[model samples]
Target: MVDRLFRMKTKSIFVRLPLLFIFFDAVRCDYFPTLYPRESETREIKELNGLWNFRADMSVNRSQGFEEKWFMSRLEKTGPVIPMPVPSSYNDVTQDKSLRDFTGWVWYDKEFFCHYHGKDRGSYTGTVYWMITTNSEEAKVQVEVVDADSNTVVMGEGIKGQASVSNVKLWWPYSMVKTGAAYMYVLKVTVKDSTSASTDIYRQPFGFRTVNKTNTQLLINNKPFYCHGVAKHEDYDLRGKGLDMVSVAKDFNILKWLGVNCFRTSHYPYAEEIMDQADQQGIVVIDESPAIGLLQQVYNLTKALDPTRLVTFASSNSNPLSDHVMNIVDVVMVNIYFGWYQDTGYLQTIPYQVPPTLEGLYKHYNKPVMVSEYGAETLTGLHTSPSFTFSEEYQKDLLIQYHQEYDKLRHEYLAGEMIWNFADFLIDQKTNWAYGCNKGLFTRHRQPKMAAFTVRERYQKMINETQKYQN
Candidate 1:
């Protein structure tokens, strides 16, 4: 859920030695896990989505689990255990108040039966290629293309491939043009071995889209695109970061109702299931890596691996004029809290301060600029007439100010604007966090505040304007 740096302290002097060794070793490690798991004809997947035995390390030093080797045996054997959901956060599942605020290693145990099949084993080699099939009613065509890594593949190796489809339907954001739907094509891959008479087939669904950027515009499929979006986190009431299909469907439905076209996975990559829904719903995603604070290295490595998509990091620095990494990024994304954090209660100064900052960043970098984050924290059901801080009115008024500034710069260098949050989420208790950050346009339960209506109106207007222009 929340991103925070952890520092382990102990009386032992050898702790630093192993940590330092790990730090250096990690720099040399280049292998990264597959982003998403898939099932093919030859490969099978089992869902581990039910209850599991759970226990938290409540010892004084919080190292009792490691000392007792709790993972080696059932959690109930070591002590009394509770049933916790596998993909959910362990914090908010019980009645104990201490468990809700626990910050230590938690152990989980699950038992499942897997049947092993014994077949004739031999050296297996295969040729893998891609077949693109159109699933639309208006068009039905299939084309075969060679894999980028060529046709040859060993038994345990993965192959990379790409193909071009002619007369393809482009993936568009929600209601961008003619109430467009997310058009995706099936990429069927077949691996065949002539000797073993073994074959594997996998079908991957992907949308045919291209992203580009000019000095003052962000283009999707070579058409100018605007992001009337929000930054989101995977937090829920009792489920926390758990994978719940009901919640996922509800969130996507609300996003459509709000006329939102895009969203950024605030500080890290989201669950693959959420991404699948994004593709199906035609929502643009600004996918982010985990928050490690190495933007330049992340940019370089990601660009080197896949140079097709535009890459940019969200800058929280108030002063963008002196930002050092602006030149290396594809777009300038700044999380400016002009009225909320900086000016603090001075809502009138937002218009004066925001425009100059955006202009400065655009002129300096000569790239498209975006206000990736801007919002005020307002408690649900709290209201004040004159737009005082911590009131719903203040939050609504602050967003209006930011939108005013965005409109002035939209056609020039401002490419997009995304509010700070889509909904309220859980975080560690702190001085500023009342339960958690209340900056969301909607509450933690997905109930809209007054600001949500404002955003919806503005976004719908933008969509209508874009549609008219395209026509």
Candidate 2:
């Protein structure tokens, strides 16, 4: 785990909210902030990850919170005040059993720093950017940034958009610029819209980075791409899928140590802070939606934000929608567990399954195919003489089978290949040994198994070989 010694150079800037009385109307406005950084310009950012005042309306009986302008400031009259953490779901925070299940209108408020240098404010624009990873269609969210004197500064209505600010710094990701530090500004988000009866607000660190894809390569900052990485889940023992900064930081450190260049938010999208860190650390991300229900409309909605990035409908099992999903996406990706689960053949047969799948998809679609997932489950510390199921030896061999073939094929039709899992994760109790999916190269606690070394050795070799093309 990484030590907590890495302090952010940027300090928190406290700004007070203003009581701006806007005319309330029955008609709802659906406009989102579309202003953001241009290709040549990087914008300033402010992280709102600390404590915030929270209130949850469980019974769906709350209009006073909005009428009284609760988002403008902390509402002292509304029940007991709960200190909620931003960039996390409110479902898993409180000890009160009712609060954990309570999911009506939740509001969050925090103060952050922004450079509002009175008059010299040039053409620079500041934006309040955040993502609503998981939410109901009925869930209405709004973000408002206010000045210290309680005047509304900038606000965004929907999931993503930018409010224009004339004076702010640019957010530079780590390793992208050697001389500059990551500078961020302050902003606020409010869910209780004066025009709506619902409120669901969220806050987190925000930044921007450039990502693009070619016929057979993914590029970040115009660098020749090779993603020697793994797919990850947000699962932890107690937090379950809730955002935990310590856990996120530790996982990032592990990625750095493992020489991983990228990762996919397997199964679902990650918290805003994690994505923000990925931008800061120069780690590429393949943000995915939930499994099985691969909706193209939602994927299109996300991809609309940045056309440069590639979006894939992550289809795991043999879904009939695979062909339809692959047609719309920029890349063809499918999760195959051929030799492990169903196609129970020897490791040699793995090559037959992988290449043919990619070739068939490419022949039809003429798009780059990527192996999004492929792995065999193996118990930690378990081994066998000749190699068998649930044995570490078998796990290592299975990964080798996939990697050796992927290395050979990447030059032609393959784009990138991400292993099924980076670490063992807790699932339901019905799962085999350890009460979780044990296909990870690392144990749940992040202990490296034999498969970790197998991939590490392979990845290091792949990294070295790919560097030649980078020149």
Candidate 3:
């Protein structure tokens, strides 16, 4: 059976499809590529991705004081419980979608004291680090920083304040060159009870890499590199969209096989392992903040916070109606995201989000920005085909207009924009006018919806024509 499968895949019709399947299959799940030299660094990483014990409380106010140096001293012995994962969120893995939907206060506690030792029996100087994420603090309170940065936190309050760490190894991404299979890293998170009679603690295995965007371009160690890549969503087979670690691994392997050097996670940030693999393979990545624009209808107070300036993220080959639709939508997306900027009084006053969003992203792990996903889908061009959208006489005039607007902003401000999607995807929802049109540069099933070659040609020209090196 295996021999027959190999023969079929070897045929031209099967072509890259079989390799694609294998690549994605391997990267998506926890498995090896059968043969290849291993990296010692890869084995060094201890992945802490799994079900973590959890508890959620909406009424109890979590301590914001944890932000201070004197925060980690608190500890509690009992609570109503559930399951969560380190490097994960309550928004995922919840059986009751309703509980997952509402973001209040979520508390997770896991007991893991590192089994792997560096040197001494129990005297080695180590640290406990955490990646703390909170839903929305407006309704509740939580801490959101990797716990290692919060070492030796002293308690200012009772045991109500708590943080967690798990024992795990560093993760591997398809970073650069011959990345060793083993990772040279460690992570620790410990909360001490100076006020209590005992040493109350929680620990985890972890490591850190600094990501910062610099100059006019993005860089990891100190070099500029463009993203050769694609965007990814969490859907395949039957596991659905939950943050399954095995699935993420399979997907990573797929990208590696495609010779993809970079990827922008559409809509929201992806699993921690995704980034870890990027680190291993030197794959450039844009870990975006979660998508909140679509939540417009979910919240009543959204429109009032149209704080960021939407300077028209138009396309170069945009059509008119599409332009108008995009002009309106960019304003909405800006409103939702920049609302935080406005609330903090940092909108136009500082080139903060624009420069630093790129810079900050590149700073930790150097990689160029795709600005990856942006723009909207136009319903006006449903009749037009893909290649013809930019054929000089396309029915869709608005598509070009959007790119034109987007191009004007290019320079040091943004690197490259993959522009939302190459095609539409299935969401099983009525939100996309019977299809998720807003996401497609092309349509579902790989059809060149009305914005295909138009985008590709223009972007290619921009790359070919511009001597960006002169700057």
Candidate 4:
């Protein structure tokens, strides 16, 4: 069977699919592609984002779809099909319970025509580093830095060389400083192969800034930085982690309104479109990998690839004293739910439970620490006077308790604090979950709960303090 599978002739298979799955075998490189897609004078990108034919392999062995070569024909012709939106988790889109709970091989395919479109440019100043990969190592590569406003070349006209920009506008997080701004510049790369008579051009947008950490603080542009932010998931009503621009715009607006300057992409990286907004708006991102284990390898490879940024993992381990990976991280990020998960119903225990753990980690490693995830589940509209678990007041008080502890050590070794969730998100049905994890400051539909107001007030105060310090 293995021999027969290997002997099968390779054939072209074109179908509507998410851009994330599209792979080009022609281009190869050592580093992972972290660049966001952009249209340029020589390059174009067409979004294949819409409804696609979908099917779940329900056969006895769950190999029927692959064995029948379903990719060669329309999915509907092979079996009963459903219209599933691209860039979304198919689990929660349908009303059927089986589909919502399905865990198996699923297929999605779409067909469309390609067209050309024009591109626009933006302006900024900064030191930008770029990398390119070509099929042939001998291909001539040229890079240019273009001033978007004047349409003039600012720097770079070489095959391989470094270009420096003096008096560069450094990118800063929102309200990180009194005069902070998210400035960006355009980089144009061109590749030509004389033998193949082929030419390709691509443009990338990047910013210049410095990020480093001391024993006590995280610094941006040589100034102390604090993350008055929340950990967010790429999830929404009906979409289930799908890329939705409307939701993205609304979320950014809310982030600004709540005075949030930084956010950790909890559990995994977010959509490239969302990242572009973060770059343009000067939002600090703690990018995270999808995998949970093998911290040493992940940390080393990430640092090697992008040494400019700090690398750390969100550890759920309560006992940090025994964490072997603590020394490997740039920042010690711990997700302790002392009040909520451990000593349940004892909100007062937070102050007592949190300090020792944080202090121990800092004393052992002498590295900056952050409360990467901490929150209590609270159902919206559920209220109680004195506050108890699963009530709105309890969630609000839990965050308040955590903040109070964080404030005590913020000036010493505490670097930042991020609440577990920015908004409510869906999860597999469990007895403990109230519909889903109700730990979000905002409800799933982006509606604010009582905890939202509490967080916003604290974050706004932090922003004011940051501005005052900058002055």
Estimate the TM-score of every prediction. 0.67, 0.58, 0.35, 0.72
Locate the minimum summed-lDDT window of 10 residues in model 4.
1-10
Give the worst 10-residue stretch by lDDT in candidate 2.
Answer: 1-10
For each candidate, C-alpha RMSD in Å?
A: 18.1, 16.4, 20.9, 15.0
Runs in model 1 lying further than 4 Å from the true structure? 1-162, 196-198, 291-293
lDDT of 2 at 204: 47
Q: What's model 4's overall lDDT?
A: 0.76
By lDDT, is 2 or 4 better?
Answer: 4
Candidate 4 positional error at 442, Å: 0.6
Which lDDT values do the candidates have, in the order given? 0.71, 0.63, 0.38, 0.76
What tens digits encode model 3's per-residue C-alpha lDDT throughout 124-169?
2223323433333322222222332244332222223443333322
Candidate 4 collision pairs: 16-110
What's the residue-level lDDT of 314 in candidate 3?
20
Residue 188 error for model 1, in Å? 0.9
Kindly state the number of residue pairs that clash in model 1: 0
Which is superior by lDDT, 1 or 2?
1
Residue 271 of model 3, lDDT score = 73
Judge candidate 3 against the unseen true structure and give its global Cα lDDT, from 0 to 1: 0.38
- Encode model 4's per-residue lDDT on 1-471: one tens digit a residue: 000101112222223342223322332223324555565784445566645667898887987877896765667568776556565777755545687788778887765433333111124345666566678767877787754232434556446566766555667786776553776766877787866443777767777788998999999878899888899999998888888755676687678868889899977889898888798778899887865677777877887888866888888874665677778888988898988889999988888888998998889888999989999998999999999889999998988898899999999999998998999999999999979988999999888899888988899899888888876
Q: Which candidate gets the maximum lDDT versus the true structure?
A: 4
